[model samples]
Target: MSGEGDTPQAIRKLSPGRLVIASHNAGKVREIAELLGPYGIEPVSAGELDLPEPEETGTTFVANAELKALQAADLSGLPALADDSGLCVDALGGDPGIFSARWAGDAKDFDLAMRLVEDRLNEEPDMPRAAHFVCALALAWPDGHVEWFEGRVDGTLVWPPRGGNGFGYDAMFLPIGGEQTFGEMDAAAKHAISHRADAFRQLVAAVL
Candidate 1:
């Protein structure tokens, strides 16, 4: 695997005008596109190219993000940006880290996953069921140059999910410095303080 400063032999440099976002999720793509727009880069999604999904076998967020970015760059012949994000609950011993997406099994039943989180913490009652969302972003050039950034938001989990705006664990996550859950906030509001947005800021700084 390529480490810091050691460019991959297979990758090539990204051109100046456009960028490819290595994700299939429309929500993620839209957010990233908006974030990168001010930098004057036209963002394209892997979903638009009908690219094959890359398997995320890496143990850490950085590893997974790099894996996806490299794969997308190779396939699309463009610079690719990828991110891996998940909620890590302290009460569960940081479980559901990488498995956050599969917590409710392969069906991706988020409702069941949220219920499971509640069930696991119900008995704790007074115990602090704190959690945090982590986002790791990777930017890979077709020529093998890659960089990564990480961002995290500490928060506690709410019992009954609230709001209907955001996706995943948004309804159950109350950020450390916020009064409402992410789902309770509008997209612009949530993006202003989200872990993904934090990471994206770093990405923009590096790229621009």
Candidate 2:
């Protein structure tokens, strides 16, 4: 993965202009679009492009994000942004770190993933099961300049997953300072204090 210093300041100097968000996930695309809305950047989603989903072969969030962003930029000949996010659990030794999405195999079976988390922690009732959602955002320009930003919200896992608002692990994860899981919060509420929102703040500082 490229270090923070590797990013060219020239990339930041470029106008916001039209930007492409390289993600097929509608939820992610919507969240990112909302975050970038204030900047007056016209955001387009990869799902709307009929582009092939690039394989995420990178080992880290930043790597994956950069890979996707660069690929999209090259494909569309436009500046692109990409984010890679996942939940990491302490008690599980981060078993689902990069594999968070595929924990239940290749079907993207999130229900099974939630069940696995519960089953894994069932034996260790006394274990301190702290977890966090991590988001890494990468901005790639057509000229190969790239920048990265990261944000995370530390929280703990709750069983029997509550709420039905957000997707994936949101139903089972509570932010550090909150009692309700992210899934319990409304979209506006979740966006106000989400890991993705934090990362977007950093991205705004760098680009806007």
Candidate 3:
């Protein structure tokens, strides 16, 4: 983690010439682009530029986000942004927090991963089914100056999964105040209240 974005300045303070989104995931890149759209910034993806997706060796979301941001910034000579996100369950003791992406592995077979989650949690069917989605966003310049923000959305787990709209564990997690699971919600609706959107608000206030 860069530990540099402790407090947002409450105003826009950034205007870069070009920015690199340091992620290869189409879903993540699209979400980020939508977030940055109002700011008059059209960012480019690391994949489009042939930048490498570095190994996520950090222990926490912020650390991994910072690593990706710094790597892209270094390689591309442009300010870079990265997001590390996951689904965490209380009963699972946050077992998949940092290893969320890893659990999906290179091929990203989240269907198999979600099945594993149900198998593990169903073993204790009487236990609490509380869970949440967490996101950490990192913004880094080529000089290594870094800013990071983390956000989360608490919710509960459901059985048999409900929808096929979202990737990862979206089908099984239901937010605290919402009836629809993330998978069941419409894309624009989900974007407005997602964990990633929460962190992006801080990113906007701190360094848009």
For candidate 3, write residues 1-208 as lDDT tens digits.
3474355343325575678999998878988888888887769999999999898998888889999999999999988989999988888999678887777877998877778777888786587888889999888888888888888999988877888887788888888899999889988888878899899887887776
Q: After best superposition, candidate 3 residue 116: deviation in angstroms? A: 1.0
> lDDT tens digits, residues 1-208, model 2?
3365455233464376788999987878988888888888999988787766888999988889899999999989998899999989898887687778778567777889989888888877688879999998988888888888888989999988999988878899999889889989988889888999898877787678
Cα deviation of 85 in candidate 2 (Å)? Answer: 0.5
How far residue 197's Cα lies from its native spot in candidate 3, in Å, is 0.9
Whole-model lDDT for model 2 versus the true structure?
A: 0.84
lDDT of 1 at 122: 76
lDDT of 1 by residue, 93-161 (tens): 886887787786777678898998888787676767899999988888777678777888889999789
Name the runs in model 3 displaced over 4 angstroms.
1-12
Model 1 misplaced stretches (Cα beyond 4 Å): 1-16, 123-125
Per-candidate Cα lDDT values, in order, are 0.82, 0.84, 0.84
- Give one clash count per candidate, in the order shown: 5, 0, 0
Q: Where does model 2 exceed 4 Å of error?
A: 1-11
Following a full C-alpha superposition, what root-mean-square deviation does model 3 have from the true structure?
2.1
RMSD of each: 3.4, 2.2, 2.1
Q: What's model 3's lDDT at 100?
A: 77
